[model samples]
Target: MAEETRTASRARAVALIADVVRWAGIIAAVILVIHVILVAGEANPANGIARTIHNLADALSLGFKDLFNKPADDPKLRTLINYGLAALFWLVVSSVAARLIRRLA
Candidate 1:
């Protein structure tokens, strides 16, 4: 009876982990698709991906600085910061998702 209980508990734990991992995959995929779309729209297809990202960071930084120098509380500035933070958050989440996917797979 004890052995059976242990086995059952282990199985349940695995199932829980699997469910979490599956959801992580779905979320990660969605994030990746969104990032690709945004990058595609902002970057020319002829540009290298690395260079594009670099250029974007530069442009965003400059814009952010310009906004900061102004009212310092502009809605557009807040929106840009929010988007940048959200993008970075999603990247970290996706990395964690990859780890979970690997473990569950």
Candidate 2:
């Protein structure tokens, strides 16, 4: 029936949206983790890997980059707070998106 086909199509769309959101969250979390590690480890900025991760994290955390500016003397603390905020931001946004998609579906 047309009704059943429409329902199936909606379900597929919802699943696709959910999957995209889930993957985005996961990738964001991974980037955050890498950023945290590089910062905590005092990775050399001149190194390619460290630079790449730092750049990726910076891009991903565009809005939250300055959410918490720790003292200059305490780089470790600053990294922790900033990266944690970024991770939280991604998780919350993705969760809300998935919920909205489900509701709409």
Candidate 3:
């Protein structure tokens, strides 16, 4: 019985960790998406909220900054593609990681 209790607790803990990973991925995706919207809409760069989101998105872009360097004339399109791909990457990686983490139980 004691061993069974330990195993159940371990499973629960793993499940919790997996959930955290999944949520984190979802959050990253949301941030990237928001940044894309802000840039495309030409939101005021001076605004504190906009600036913060832009910084976060820049960091999360995962070196996709230039990405192909196409569409140089349209900054909005560039941001949408690069940041959008980064967001999708995080979502996929996090989901796979969560699944692998759950398997540890």
Candidate 4:
């Protein structure tokens, strides 16, 4: 009876973790979509952060001129690439985490 109780408790914990992970993934996706919309506006406060990131990229490109060729590589281009990569990373990570949690549950 004690062993059965332990197994049930473990199962309940897994379910709880899975639910949390699922919610987190949903929230992150929603946030990313909102951010994209705000960025598209180009006049929102969110744009300030985006601008700063762009400027930093520009500075890095300048410092590492040899790293990125002209025309093919620019601050805006780098920012887009970086952001795309980051979004992909988060999406995959969150999704995998959620899947694993769900399986455990």
Top candidate when judged by lDDT against the true structure: 3
Across 5-87, the per-residue lDDT of candidate 1 in tens digits comes to: 99788877866776675565455444434444545456554667646644454443333323334436553444345445544
Better of 2 and 4 by lDDT: 2
Candidate 4 lDDT over residue span 1-105, tens digit each: 999999899988887887787666555544444444444455345566655644443333333323334346454454344444444555666778877876755
Q: Which of the two candidates, 2 or 3, achieves a greater lDDT against the reference?
A: 3
Question: Candidate 3: which stretches are off by over 4 Å?
Answer: none
Ordered from best to worst lDDT, the candidate numbers read: 3, 2, 4, 1
Which regions in candidate 2 have their CA more than 4 angstroms from the true location?
A: none
What would the TM-score be for candidate 4 when compared with the true structure?
0.51
Clashing residue pairs for model 3: none
Clashes of each: 0, 0, 0, 0
lDDT of 4 at 49: 69
Number of the candidate with higher TM-score, 1 or 4 = 4
Candidate 3: tens digits of C-alpha lDDT, residues 2-56: 9999989998999999999999999999999999999999999999999999999
| Per-prediction TM-score to the true structure, in the order listed | 0.35, 0.89, 0.95, 0.51
What value does the lDDT take at residue 64 in candidate 4?
A: 35
Model 1 scores worst on lDDT over the 10 consecutive residues at 60-69
RMSD of each: 10.5, 1.4, 0.9, 6.9
